[model samples]
Target: MASIALVDDDRNILTSVSIALKSEGFTVRVYSDGETALKALAENPPDLAVLDIKMPRMDGMELLRRLRERTAVPVIFLTSKDDELDEALGLAMGADDYITKPFSQRLLIARIRAILRRTEARAEPEAPDEAQPAAEPIVRGRLSMDPARHRVSWNGQDVVLTVTEFLLLEVLAQRPGFVKTRDQLMDTAYQDDVYVDDRTIDSHIKRLRRKFRAVDPEFKAIETLYGVGYRFAEE
Candidate 1:
């Protein structure tokens, strides 16, 4: 049974979601605030986290920012229907996905299962050492991406990326100079069968650039094509 941490101030939400997840055979752990959730997570991480954006002391965004520093555990944000900016910002800050308030329990379950499936798929064991070359690292002008290891580096300096960011960057860097439409990226990067808007893709791209730029201030490997989409700069 996979363990899930649910963080939200609303007792009603906690009770409802916890019951639903438990019925699905998930070990549900509920926290009423981000501070408690964060402390518990650092001590023993869960398979997935569902966080509400409006928590006091430490909001979902802040908890995510701090959590990413310690673990790459997948996260899903909960936000109000009108919190468009918060949703985009949460994605930029490395959240895997977000669901607006008044969301259906069925939709939430589907999303959770999708993310879990992806996570499990990614963790599958690798082939024998002799067959390793088949999954070689992707190299592009000082940027290296190892899909087999799920690692990325710029100028030989290691950089951390969330699972979604890693998938998005891998898709672009593997096909340097090829423009990937927002829809294409959505299909490829977010394989959970969810419909994420173009703005979500934009936020992810912006954060991707920021991560690489931190290692190399002259990082220009990712380029935007104005009204079109984005591409990885060819060497």
Candidate 2:
């Protein structure tokens, strides 16, 4: 059974979501604030975390920032309805996905399941086959990606990325100098049943670049094409 950590200030949300997730066979852990969640998360991480943006003590943004420093555990944010800024910021902070407030429990569950599925797929090992060759690490300029291990690095320095960000980068780096339209990237990162807008893709790309730049100030492998999409430069 997958374990889930739900961090929110609202008591009702903690109770209701915990019960719902438990009914779905998930081992649910609830935190009423981000500060408490952060400490517990570091000691014992969960399979995934669902965080609320507006909370006393420590906000979700701060919690996510701290979490990303240590663990790449998948995160899903809960934003207030119509809070586009919060949604974008959360995505840029390494959240795998987000659900707006007053969201259907069904939709929230679906999003959680989809992210978990992707995480599991990446960790699952392929069966040995003599004819089927093993997957090789992708190398482009200073970037290196090991799909089998879900690891990425730049200039020999490790860079942590969420599952969605990793998938988006893999698609773009697969074909250097090839532009991956927003629609194509969305399809690659998100499940067909889940819908995410163009802006979401843009935010993930921005975050990806920011991470790479942290390690290499002159990193310019990812290039943007006005009104077209994005591409990994041919190096």
Candidate 3:
């Protein structure tokens, strides 16, 4: 079972998230503060981390920034507010993905498993005698992306990502100007049989854009389609 850390200041949120992750067969560890969680990571890093945006001792964003400097482990933020600005900031700071308040357990499980699946897929060994490409070795100005190796590099440097993040980029790249509804992404990428809401797709995409934008200041590659869904790299 993959080990996952859950960091939330609220006891209820911690317990609920822990139970949800454990039910999915993950080895779950709960920390009520950023300080404790950070220390635990220093000693024994979990395969993935699910953090709350607001926590005592150190906020989620600060902890995430420090964590990125030391590890590329995936991080999923839990935020009560649904502000675009906060989502952008968290992603820019290196968060892999997130779940807003009132999200369902099923959706959370889907995100966790999807990320793990993608991470494992990307780590697969190369064919005998075939050399594996370096990480994020491709770029396309503000819209850098990779299809073969499952990575994306904005501008010139690598932007840390989880498996889900890379696949989301892939789906967007397949149709640059056309709108991709949330349902389309779910039908194409979300393997969970359960019908997860479109907001889940939106949430992950929001986080993905933040990280890309941090690397490219003019980044607006993933564009919203108002009442519909989203488009990518509009020509």
Candidate 4:
């Protein structure tokens, strides 16, 4: 069974989400504070994490920042209804997704399953003695993206990206010079009916560029079009 860690200051939220996830056959671990969650996560990482952004002591953002330093476990953040900035920041900080408070149990479960399915699908590898070769890694200019290995490099230096970032980049880079509107990117990167907005997608794109630029100062592979969307540079 895939394991999931739930971190929230509210016991009720933890209990409800844990019960729902457990009922669906997921191994769930609960933490009521960011400090405890951070420690537990460092000691024993879960397959996925659900974090509340307003927790005491460390807060979800700090915990996530710390988490990124160590592991690449997929994370889904929980935020208040009005905390759009927090949600965007969480996404830029490498969270896989975020859901607002008073969220539906069904929606939460659906998001969890969708994320897990994507991660699991990517984790599967071809048999060592297989005959056919794997698909070639997508290469654009000085950037390289390997879907099978889930790796990205710029100018021959490694650049880490969350799953969402990776997927978004792939969607654009695969079709260089083809402008993809925000709606198209959301449709490509997220499951059906996911409510990601333009600003959220922009934040992820910004983060992706920042990550690549850290390794290659002249990174200009991703381009923005005013009043439209973005595209990967053809050259």
Candidate 5:
């Protein structure tokens, strides 16, 4: 069974979400603040986390910034504010999804299930014993992405990426010479039963390309396949 951690300062929200998740056959651990959640993750990470945006000890954005430094756990943010900047920032920082407060319990549960499904689907493919050596990290000039480490570093300095960005990059890198359709990328990267449009993906890719270019100008080689999707060209 997939185990998840729910972090929110509101005891009532935490209690309700815990009950909802349990009914869906998930094991849940609830925390009242981001501080405890962070400590728990450092101890033993859960498969997924649901975090509230505003908390007393530590806010969700700060927690997210910190989380990106170490792990790639899929997270869904719960925020009371309907600010677009916060939404974009949260996603850019690596959050999988955001739910505004007064959200439907059903919608939250559905989103969690979708995230969990995608997480399971994106698990690394097995390699043959000989192929194990072939699974070495991908280094394109100064850009290096290490699947084994779940880390991306440019100019020998790590670049903080959200879970979605990491997965998108992984999908592209795994297919060195081939372009991936948006649906294919979504299936491989998200792997959850979801439909992620080109815009959502483009924003992530744009950020990634920009970051890479900032570090190494020649890093814009991530080719957009016109009407298709994206490919990390070996060209």
Candidate 6:
């Protein structure tokens, strides 16, 4: 059973979501504020976390920023229905996903399951194949990706990425210099049934670039073409 931590200031949301997640067989932990969640999470990290953007003391954004410094636990932000900026900022700050307020419980559950599935798949070890050789790590310029290990490095420095970001980078780097439309990248990163806006993909790409740049200040492997798509530079 996957464990989930939910941090929100709303009592009703915490209670309702806890019950819903428990009914679905998830081990649920609830925190009424981000500060409490941050401390507990550092001591005992959950499989995934659902965080609300607004709260007393430390808000979700600060909590996420602090968490990203220590862990890569998948995070899904809960924002107000009209808070598009929050959603985008959360994604750019390393959140794996986000859902607006007044969202369907069913939709939230589906999103959680989808993210868990991706993380779980990445954690599982690949079985050896006698007839086929092991897949080689993809190396393009200063970037290197080991798909089986879910590891990425740039110029010998490790770069951590969420499952969504990793999938997007893989798809683009696999065909360097070939522009992949936003739709194509979305289809690759998200489940077929799950729907995400163009901005979501753009935010993830922005985060991806930021992560790579952290390791290499001169990183310019990811190129964006306005109004068209993005491509990995052929080096």
Question: Best candidate per lDDT, number?
Answer: 2
lDDT tens readout by residue for model 6, 1-235: 9999999999999999999999989999999999999999988999999999999999999999999988899999999975757866886688887777787676688778878886786676766763445457899988899976777899898886656678899999999999999999878876636677888789778878877887788888899999998999998
User: Model 6 Cα RMSD, Å?
Assistant: 5.3
State the lDDT at 77 in candidate 2.
91
For model 1, how big is the CA root-mean-square deviation? Answer: 5.2
lDDT for position 76 in model 3: 86
Candidate 1's C-alpha lDDT?
0.84
TM-scores of the candidates are 0.66, 0.66, 0.73, 0.67, 0.62, 0.65
lDDT of 2 by residue, 98-196 (tens): 777887675577678878887887777767673445468999988999986778999999887766788899999999999999999988887636676
Q: What is the C-alpha RMSD of each candidate to the true structure, in Å?
A: 5.2, 5.4, 4.3, 4.9, 5.8, 5.3
Stretches off by above 4 angstroms in model 5 are 9-20, 32-48, 61-134
Clashing pairs in 4: none
Expressed as tens digits, the lDDT of each residue in 40-138 for candidate 1 is: 998899999999999888999999999999999889999998575886688768787788789877557767886787678677676787433436789
User: Which candidate number maximizes TM-score?
Assistant: 3
Candidate 2: minimum summed lDDT over ten consecutive residues — where? Answer: 126-135
Model 6 residue pairs with clashes: none
lDDT of 6: 0.86
**99: Cα error in model 5, Å:** 8.3
Whole-model lDDT values for every prediction: 0.84, 0.87, 0.77, 0.85, 0.77, 0.86
Candidate 1 TM-score, C-alpha based: 0.66
Write candidate 5's Cα lDDT for 86-149 as tens digits: 7667876888877777877766776777677656655746567634343478886656887655
